[model samples]
Target: MKKFLKVMLVCVMVLFAFTLVFGTSKKDEKEGIVIGFSNASVSNSWRVFMVANYEHEVTLHPEIAASYYTDADDKPEKQIADVDDLLVKGIDVLIISPAVQDAVNPAVEKAFDMGIPVIVFDRKVTTDKYTTFIETSNYEMGKAQGEWLAKELNGKGKIVAFSGVAGSGPAEDRWKGAQDAFSKYPGIEILGQQYTDWSPPKAKGVMEAFIQQFSQIDGIWADSGLMSWPALEALKEAGRPLVPSTGEQLNAYAKFVVKNNLRGFIYPFPAWMSRIAVQYAIKAAQGEKLPKYIEIPVDPIGPDEIADYVQMDKSDFWWVGDDQMPEEFLPSFD
Candidate 1:
C-alpha cells in the first residue's frame, strides 16, 4: 500500500509540472511586444476619439504584450520629454503625432536611431527619419471643400476663409490646397482669411466681426468644419441669410447643415488613422516590410451623404463618419 501511494503521488506531481509548463508557454506566446504611443494632445473630442481607437486596437491583439501612451497637452517641450520616456521603456515601436511640425523631429529621429520602428501619424516632423508616416491628404480635403463651395456659389462669390491652428501641417497644407482650387475659379473671391485656433468661440467672434464689416458675403470657407457651427451661430445672431460653406466632418456641423438646409461640404479626417498607425507599428516591429508613407484618402462628405454619417444622439463634439467602432466601444465624456 505504501509503494502504491508513493507512485500515485509522483504521477500527480508530473502532471502538475506539465500543466505549469504548458500554461507558461501559452502566457509567453501572448506577452512580448510592447508598443508606445506619444500623442500631441487629448484636449479636444477628435484627439480623445483617436486615443480611444488606439486603445481599442491594442485590446484586439493578444501579441501586444503592453501599451504605453503619453499626452503632450499640445506642448512641444512636453512631447519631446514624453517620447524620451517612451524610448526608455524599451518599447519595440514608437507611434507619434507631433505637437509641433518641426520641434518634435529630434525625439523621432532619436527613436529611429535606437533601432525602434517609428510610425508618425496625423501630424509630421520636419525630417523624414521615421520608418512610416500615416496621414490624410490635407491638400485634397481643402481642394474638395473649395470645389464644392465654388459649385454652390455658381463659380462666383465673396467668401471668408477660416483656418485651424496656425503653422500646423494640416492647416498649412489645407490652406494651400484651398487656395489652389479657388484660384481656378477667378470669379470666387476670398474676402478675408484668419486663423481660428480651431475654436468655435473664436470662429464666432471672427464671423461676427466679418458680419459687422461686410454686408453681402456669399460664402464661408473653413478648412476645419469645426468652425462651421460657430460661424452659423454668428450669422444667425446677425440675422444674415445662409450661404454656401466649407468645413470638416463633425456630426454637430452636419446636423446643423441638414436641419437648416444649408449648402455645405464636409471633409472628415478619420479617427482611425491612429489605429492604422498602430497596425503598421506592430507589423514593422515584427520585422515585416512597410510602406514609407501611407496616405489616408480625403473623401468629402456631400450633402446627399450627410445623413448617412451623422449620429444625432452622440455628443456635439463627435466627428462624422467615425463609425470604426460602436458607440459603447468608448465612453462619451459628456
Candidate 2:
C-alpha cells in the first residue's frame, strides 16, 4: 500500500515539474521582442532588393524572436493601417518607410506614444516622435547628378527630368536639389519634368511623349535607375543619339553606359537601408543609445567607375549592398 502511494506521489511531482518547465518557456517566448516593419512598397526592383536584404538580415539575429511586415503599396492610407495592425500584434519595435510625410505622421506618433521604439527609414514623417531615421541625402544625390550634367553639357542644354512617384519625399527632395543646381546656370533649360512612378513602362511612355514634343533634347536626369534604361530605349526608338544622363548603379544601366560610351553618372542609392533599419530597431529594443538621424553617403559612378560596380551576371536591377551582405547575397532574377 505504501509503495503504491509513493509511486502516485512521484508521478504527480514529475507532472508538476514538466508543467513548470513548459510554462516558463512559454512565458519567455511570449515576452520576446517582435520587430515590425511597415514598408512603403515592394512595387519596384529597388524595393524588392531592400525587402530581400531585410528578410536575410532578420535571420542573422537570434535575439529577434519573430518579425512582421506589411506592404503599403505606396499608399499612405494603407501604411497607416499597416502600422495599426502591427501594433495589434504587440510589437516591441516599429520600423517604417513612410509613403508620405504628412499622412504617416500621426501613425508614427501613435507608435511613439505607445512606448514602442520607432525607426523610420527611406522616407520620413513630419513629426520628430520616431526614435531613428535612416536615409540617403536625396538633395545631395540630385545635386551631384545635376552638377555633372551641367559640366558634361557645358552648363547649357535642354534636359528632361524624371522623378519617382509624385508627392513622395525622395522625389520632392531630388527635384528640389536638381533645381537648385540648374538654377545657377541660366543657359540650362528644363524641357519637361514628369513623374515616372519609378516604373520603366511609365517612363517610356513619358519619354515617348517628350520626344514627340521636342526635337532637341540635350540630356536626361532621373531620381533613380528605374527610368535610365527606358530613357535609352525611348531615345533609340525615336532615332535620337544617346545623351548625357544620370541614374543609380544598376547592372543594366552600368552596362548601357559602358557599351555606348555615354556621358552618364550613377549616383547610387544603396538598397541596404532596410537592413540598417532592422539593425537600429534591434539596438533600440536592447536599450542601446541610437542617433536620431543616420545619413548614408552617395557613391557616384562615372564612366571610368562603371566597371567596379557592374556585375553582368546579376540581374539588371541589382545594386551594391553594404558590407554585412555576402557577395552572393543578390537574389537571382534572371
Candidate 3:
C-alpha cells in the first residue's frame, strides 16, 4: 500500500506537468493569430463595401483566431486612438485605412516601432514605417478623368470640380493630378472647386450652388459617382442640359450614363482592394515577406464601354468594381 501511494503521487505530479505544457499549447492553438483593423469610416457606399469585404475575408482565413475593428467616423484623432486601442489588444498584425494623410502618421509609425507589421490601404500615411501599402493610383484616376473631360470639351470649357473629403489622401492626390492635367490645357478654365465629403446630399447642394453662381458651367469634373450622380440631378432640376462628366465605377453611375446616353468617363478605384490588404496582413503575420507597395491596375470605362459595365439590376449603391466579391456580399436594392 505504501508503494502504491508513492506511485500515485508520482503520477499526479507528471499529470500536472503535462497540463502545464501541452495544455498551454492547446490554448495557444485554439487562439490562433489575432488581427486588428482600424478603418477610417463607412461614410460612403464604397467604404461600406470595403469594410464588408474585409470582414468576409477574415472569416475565410481559419488561422485568424480573432479580429478587432474600429471605425473613426472620419476623424483622424479618433483613428489614432482606435489604432492605439487595437495595439493594446495584442494583435499580431495591424491594418489601417487612415482618415487623413498627415494626421494619422504618428500612430502608424508607433505600431511599426513596436515591431508590429502594419498594412495601410486605400488612403496612405506620410511615413514609410509600414509593412505594405495596397492601393490603386488615385493620381492616375484623376489625371485620366481630367484628360477625358478636356477632350470632350475640346480643351476649352468652364468646368467645376468636385472632390471627396478634404485632407484625405485619395482626395488630395486625385485633386493634384486633375489640376496637373488641367494645367496642360491652357484653354480649360476651372470656375470653382468644392469638397463634397462623398455625400450625395451635400454634392447636390454644392452643385446647386455652383449652378446659381456660374453663368456658363460647361463640364463637371467629379472624382466619383457619389458626387456626379447628384450633380446630374441638380442640373436636371435646374433645367440645364447634362454636361460631360467624369465618375468612378459605380453601378448607379454606369446605369445613369447608359440610360441617359450621357457622355461620361468612369474610372475604378476598386473596393476589392480591401480583400488584398487582408491577404497581405495574414502573410505578414505568418512571417512571409511582402512588397512594400502593391499597386492594382485600373482601366477607365469610356462611353463605348459603359453599357457593358452597367448593372441595371443591382442597387444604386453597388460599386461595379466589386465583381470579385461573393454574391452574398454584394449590395442589393431589396
Q: Which candidate has the highest lDDT of all? A: 3
In model 1, the runs with Cα more than 4 Å from the true position are 1-30, 326-328
Q: Which stretches of candidate 2 lie over 4 Å from their true place?
A: 1-31, 322-329
Query: Which should have the higher TM-score, number 1 or number 3?
Result: 3
What's the ranking of the predictions by lDDT, best on top? Answer: 3, 2, 1
Query: Model 1, poorest ten-residue lDDT window?
Result: 1-10
TM-scores of the candidates in the order shown: 0.87, 0.88, 0.90
Model 1 error, position 61 (Å): 0.8
Clashing pairs in model 3, backbone N/Cα/C closer than 3 A? none
What is the lDDT of every predicted structure here? 0.79, 0.80, 0.84
Give the alpha carbon lDDT tens digit for every residue of 1-334 in model 1.
2243234334433433443344345445665577778888764567666776776676677677767677786788999999999888677899998887888889999999999999998887779888988999877888888888888888998999998877677778888888998989999988899988777778899999999989988998898767877898789778999887877777778878888888778888898888899889889999998888899986677878777767888767777656577654553534
Rank order by TM-score, top first?
A: 3, 2, 1
* Model 3 agreement with the true structure over 159-231: per-residue lDDT tens digits: 9999999999899889998999999999999999999888888999999999999888899999999899889
For candidate 3, the TM-score is: 0.90
Using TM-score as the measure, which candidate wins? 3
